[model samples]
Target: MSRKIERLINLTIALLATKRYLTKSEIFRSVEGYEGSAETKERMFERDKDDLRSLGIEIEVGSFDPLFNDEAGYRIKQEKYQLDLGAITSTEVSLLSLAAQAWQGASFDEAAQKALLKLNSMGVPSDSLSLPTAAHKIDDGGGDLPLITKAIAEQQLITFTYVDSQLDRHQRKVVPVGLSSRSGFWYLSGVDQDVQEIRTFRIDRIEGEITSTKGPKDFEPPQGFDPARVFDGSSSQSFAIIDVRKGKGTSLRALATSAQSLGEWDQLKLPIYNLNTLASLVLWHGIDVYVQEPLELRGLIVAQLETLVSNHG
Candidate 1:
């Protein structure tokens, strides 16, 4: 672990072990890793508190010296810091083990592993049962996901240039409310400042870096605004009819209106949110898929394949 992470761990352990809140000066003097001038130590402690809070550790700040007006002290309440799940069956433990294993090689693998280790240290027995390797894996949503997630968590206003399904580009100012994934795509749902409406933007379609328009906690998500209900993935008017091979096109099936089996293929009528996206999914199946209706979509797929062939040739 790096120095910062080690410091955070030490800081957490120190806070958790203390019976009463520890003052900032006490922490700076007693904490093993805190070594700097008074100002530097104060700044580092402030950032460390934020980082620990971001990781779901609840650090309570209160005055330890009630007799006099003493500076505020900080401590992580054991009740808030520890998991309180009453009981776990063997089946649940096995499921948790499998869930932990599923994060292997993904961006969150380290954090998942650490969580499992912590749980195991709490006396949960490990199951010997093995599960089949996962066929589908989570995408990291490029690098913007963390930024968007932070924006949502902090309720910050953000600005980004986004390209819509019709390939129209616009600079959007939004107060990010939530982040969700659908069919391997990550979306950021927010209140669009220009339109003054709730809208969802696919993270991948964001043209450039997402920048914060204001400080954290700048806006509030509307009451009972669930991103699941807001993001329907049907933003375009056009739809496509295609034939997919059996056991394929699972993601496409979710957006399809109707499906009928035709021997080796499953005929599907899917809404065309973006022709480019539809064409790309069709090409992903290669020879196993074919467009049945709308000559325009077929032409788009053929043109894409021709371009690929020309580029390779």
Candidate 2:
């Protein structure tokens, strides 16, 4: 990390750790990388404020007194600064188990661990990813993971109630084919008997119990069916070059194959293990992270953001 990035992380940690707004004098005395003459420190502080805002981190500026004009103080509101992905759906242990089967020790292992550390520092529990490989074993509120895994292993037909992205609830019958995992979510891709087509279902979104409709080896997976490519047609892996705003997209920075300083934005060549997974990660950084290559990935990011705005409009 550069001195500036270290300063920014330290600054963020300090501001987020405090309950009260810290004044400029207090910040200079306490926060690292704020050295130099008073005038120099003032300039650095102003630039830091701009950089933080560019990362979509809101710094609250207020005064100590309402009646008398006092020196302004700064603090960040957790509700505003933190990405409220909303308790984020938990990772399914079964998905991790499935991933462990096909994980194959890829480029994301190191970056994944670093991202876990960053998340843990932000007060997110470390249990989800206590260790690199152990990270894949944690539960994601998918209590039916074991059942799903068992159904797959037995080659049995299973029935379960699932809620789709649109919140439509329906009972699904699937002839277990193969399993796929990405970004902590487990997906069961198989032949949906009712729809008479292959569909991928997120394990966590599955509601109620998964019942085995028949004995083991009840059905065979469709000929030449590829679970990873089912429904969404997601590639196994992709490489992307991203334009990350300075002092932002810290997670991406950690995962980049190469990062070059581009003044305002850092150009990062990153290996994308899963495009949807990478898309979600990039979206988390908001405008601070921009995809400069792989137009498909950029389109996905924009489409997801637009859907969020449209649905929540």
Listed in order, each prediction's TM-score against the native is 0.59, 0.38
Q: In candidate 1, which residue ranges exceed 4 Å CA deviation?
A: 1-15, 22-59, 64-74, 83-86, 128-133, 213-218, 230-313
Give one digit per residue, the lDDT tens place, for model 1 in 1-313: 4988888998999999999989988898888878878888889999999999888899998987789898999999998989776687666676776777776776677777897787777676766766665776667657676677777877778999999777899999998888788878888888998887888888889998889856434455689877776546445577788998999878778778889999989999987766777788889878888898789998998889899999999
Q: With candidate 2 superimposed using the best TM-score fit, by how many Å does residue 268's alpha carbon deviate from the native? A: 4.4
Our model 2 lands, by Cα RMSD against the true structure, at: 27.3
Q: So what's the TM-score on candidate 2?
A: 0.38
How much is the lDDT of residue 136 in candidate 1?
60
User: Model 1 misses residue 54 by how many Å?
Assistant: 8.1
lDDT of 2 by residue, 196-268 (tens): 6777888878888888867434455668878766533243366899999998888788777788898998899
Best by TM-score: 1
